[model samples]
Target: MLAAATAAVLLLFLVALVMMAAAAFAFAVLMLMAVP
Candidate 1:
């Protein structure tokens, strides 16, 4: 039971990390487009 809970927490952390990375990437792209 403890292992399952830990796994779920890790999965959620990974999802959050991926979302943050995607947002950062999108922001960078927008900045580049606006610069030119």
Candidate 2:
């Protein structure tokens, strides 16, 4: 049971990390477009 809970937490953390990375990438693209 403990292992399962830990796994769930890890999965959530990974998803959050990916989302943050994607958001950062999108923001960078938008900034580039606006500047040029």
Best by lDDT: 1
Best by TM-score: 1
TM-score, cand. 2 vs. native: 0.96
Off by over 4 Å in 1: none
- Model 1 lDDT tens row, 1-36: 999999999999999999999999999999999998
Give the alpha carbon lDDT tens digit for every residue of 1-36 in model 2. 999999999999999999999999999999999996
lDDT of 1 at 34: 100
Q: How do all models score by TM-score? A: 0.98, 0.96
Per-model lDDT: 0.99, 0.99
lDDT for position 34 in model 2? 100
